[model samples]
Target chain A: MPQTGRSGCPINLTLEQLGDRWSLIVIRDVMFGNRRSYGELLAQSEEGIASNILADRLKRLTASGLLTRRPDPKHRQKGIYSLTEAAIQLVPLLAHMGAWGRRHTRSSKELSVRAELLEKGGAPLWNAFMDELRHLHLGAPRPARSVFGELQAAYEKALARRARYAQD
Target chain B: MPQTGRSGCPINLTLEQLGDRWSLIVIRDVMFGNRRSYGELLAQSEEGIASNILADRLKRLTASGLLTRRPDPKHRQKGIYSLTEAAIQLVPLLAHMGAWGRRHTRSSKELSVRAELLEKGGAPLWNAFMDELRHLHLGAPRPARSVFGELQAAYEKALARRARYAQD
Candidate 1:
């Protein structure tokens, strides 16, 4: 990312850093999927991001300070990537974006469950989730509340409800 | 703008719809710059967006139902673009984005004033701003409060302060 944006406009700068479709997807995987390795990010991606594009985005994200890459102790050839504080702070932005999409777009129930939970849970939930993320990605002490477990349980419950409704 | 996203994830859907750099910029201009006509949107753009990119984004945004383009009454050859209810509802999203960018990025004081105000003012202020936007763009009954005026004044004051600091 460029040190200077097209203009000093905050929105423009944010867009410049993370406005593309792939960058946030990478962040989302790190945050939600816990896919820290390049292979995992590549193979587990539902969006089917191209290998070259994924490689480019990882480099860009690392350079932009949203991600940090470190050598994996287990394998000299492999590197493990982790979210930096900057990327962890994107929870609210991602939550709001997810909320907007759920309300406005042709969203799937299973896919949108997280967004619904985030919207209903609001800032308190978001803060807890971010705290949990810091622990997961940054080695911080885990919070007493597991917002991730709460969110995942909610999502799984919604999925079960949808499965029942589908049978009916 | 495809009907289906790469995945059904709400965040991915939103990214697919608006993940590009220029789409939101076009929206920002129409919403804040009050540049209703194509010419105004083109000429007054701070980012100097290319004409082709602008044309493409306008078409994409209109296709996505974020904007409505109608023949200008004053100029038979010109079209005036207005925000739909969907776009107006984006005030909160934009405000949060601006706030995130202001804190995380190297934003300028003059440019970030609006974001600062939105952060300080929160949802009540966003609702008022959206109401004012609805009045301006959708021809709704104008709200008595001038949130736009208030925001613009804050931006101007920030600009003046920057100018003074520059002189110093």
Candidate 2:
């Protein structure tokens, strides 16, 4: 179909698109921290992806429909990047990767907490989490019963706490 | 710990080592097929990984203890690469990645068959598959019973079929 991959295997094709080192880190920032601006993503990434590489990956990911870049209503020079439905669906993959890492590698206590929460919540939680984002920004259908209500509340609380610290 | 990774998150550390485009592909070739030599690996990889990049990745993987390379007993010019226990443990991750690909992307029919086999076999099957390699090359302990009897049997049958075809 598309001429973007070396093999016809879907997994290989997807890996060809998303398997690079920087792309997932960018996606991780978008999915976890609500960090979409270039500066926010670049700052949060521990890997120190080059600015050129970051720009290239952002362009490619957007072209692939995994991310969307829209004009920031609040800022003129900045663009807000958001995950698309296809990208949001990757939460399971990301969660599994994180879980595997937690099991096999040395991880931080705070990181493990997030991984455990995601694991305990399972696919339904991820689905509802995505639905919440859609409801907030994309006007998509809402979850049947606000399944992630408490988790989202907790997340918001944490964000507010961080914002308060930033003020100081 | 060694100063190689960006974060204490185990996944990040593992990704630091294995997150590149070529590392997993190299591991996959060693695990699934009988590819061991530099020439064989290069031949099997359709994506045309740069020779320098391939050399670098192989060295890094070996340094990380995921693979071991030695002189080919029968061929002095070639080196025989074998998977270590760490690499074998990656079967689950690889299987999951393949399954994810099969579920989401367009893939090759032949490759999908292999992925389905891995999926149906589950983790124990993956363990047994690794044990088979260990027994064959590494002198590692064998399973109490024929844990991967079916898979081993299938491999033999396929080998025989290939021999017959080659003779014809």
Candidate 3:
């Protein structure tokens, strides 16, 4: 991110903030997997994000106000990263991105299952998911909707299906 | 980009397609500015994209199936570019991204005006805009809604407002 010198398009501004592949990947991990600590994010990285890159993205996201880092009370040195309201609002955009990818890419059955659910679930699901995120990351009241649970269950089922297919 | 071995998250796959800053900028020009020719895109660029980068992104986008290119009938050697159905479907994601930028970044008022309209207009406007994009880029029958017109008018109005403010 450069100094705030832009007087240009909003999408360009957004691309500056999020165009880096790793930034959104990190955000996805946090948003979906509830990976907060650096260790959790690094350990669970499906794309094998490098340590230095993860560190830099975490710093950048914090600086960009998409995330906030607070010292983990359980550990002196560790930080717990939480999504801000702005990032919570990204549910729809993420849903759209996922939906687009599932439709267009050679995405795997197991991985794309979530996107399929999101596309099927639409705005109501996205909003419910956002409320859930707010509860998880921002201390908002817990919503009755369990989109996160549903998405996780779907992913697990797809994984099982892939496993059975692989055995054949 | 790396030959479709990915069996990962849809957002990651989508990010692989769209994480580049220049690609979306070029798409924005085509979608919003209606700049199909390389010459037209180069001349009207607000962010001063280099010719080589633009050419390369155009080639990549065409190869990636988000855009298609055909030799301009009016010109011997020049080519005209147009968005594919997949690209047209990106309106909602682009709208969300622009809205996020407007909310979080130092985006100028005149530039962010379009984002504001999209955010306020929401899905109906985005669907209308997509229909208009389909009409322009895919030879679909022209829709009754003219979101493109409204966005263009709003942008021009903002530009005039900017010009007036610059005098002070």
Candidate 4:
């Protein structure tokens, strides 16, 4: 298919394909939160993505080969969304974006905890997380390490620290 | 200033602030092309951003601390734009995005050369480039090594290669 981009510049093409406010968020929800259905994505999103926008982004992402859609075997009316390998590979990019935001923006401690750990863990952790994601979303063999568990533990620890600080 | 991001999640915050098709492109032009004036940005842009959108994004970027705008000493009626520390920090994110695009999307050889070099050069090159940008835009002392020159040279070589291929 002819690429529908403003220009052939790789960055511009990427932006054209997934540069909107909602596309990567949809991918993030699917990849990180394991929200496989539209309803799950709509209800669980922290960013309050509108249903219409979510619908549009899902179609776009699926068309762009970043996501795959199939009828839910458990419920035919609902479609299940899963990340393509392309979307799964975006872990590093999202990790870097999260790290940058944590440093430069006024982010919430709880919300930014994952980004901090990702930054601290660097690419090795990112690769491990991607492996876990593949197992979850693509039926791949699970990696030996649980980077997700490590990240969650770190976040919980950070939250506990914040709570102690609040009391002090 | 209170951040205007949609959520405290670092990725969501970054996207809300700059997930549009044009915001990062504008920053990229200012950072890479050294387009310091509005007319220069508008006229030299490959994507043909509408004037109203450019104006609005410039205002938003300035407000969000990604860009600084100043009265032009050469022209009283016009203004000069420069990347702030926040924007200079976006180099890695943009680079990764570019690299991903080159891998997954149809991309131009000449346009993707910078991203290729960035992937090859990694953090040391990014740090050097950021140091150079700080000196150029923020009055910091210039680094002895010119990462910018190296990137420019790579782009020029890629363009020449593309030209030779086109002729053949």
What TM-score goes with each of the models? Answer: 0.95, 0.73, 0.94, 0.93
What DockQ do the predictions score, one after another?
0.83, 0.41, 0.72, 0.79
Cα lDDT tens digits, model 3, A1-168, are 553444467888888788766788899999988899999999889888899999999999999899999999889799999999999988888889998888887777788888888889888889899999999999999999888899999989988988898899
Model 2 regions lying over 4 Å from their true place: A1-4, A103-106, A116-168, B1-4, B117-168
Q: How displaced is residue A147 in candidate 2, in Å? A: 8.8
lDDT of 2 by residue, A33-101 (tens): 678789987887766767888888888888988888898888878888888877776776676677667
- Candidate 1's clash total is 0
Name every residue pair that clashes in candidate 1: none
Candidate 1's residue-wise lDDT over A36-123, tens digit each?
A: 9899999999899899989999999998889999999999778899999989888988888899899888888888888998999988
Cα lDDT of model 3 by residue, B1-168, tens digit:
443444367788887877776788899889988999999998889888889989989999999999999999989588899999999989889898899888877788888888999999998898989988989999999999899899889989999988998999
Superposed by TM-score, candidate 4 places the C-alpha of residue A149 at a distance from the truth, in angstroms, of 2.0
Instruction: Give model 1's docking category.
Output: high
Model 1, B52-138: lDDT tens per residue? 999988888888999999998888899889999989988878888899899889988888899999989988998999999999999
| B60-80: candidate 4 lDDT, tens digit per residue | 999989999999988888889
RMSD of 3: 1.9
Scored by TM-score, the top model is 1
Give the TM-score comparing model 1 with the true structure, all chains together. Answer: 0.95
In angstroms, give how far residue A71 of model 1 lies from its true place: 2.1
For model 3, state the Cα shift of residue B1 in Å: 6.3
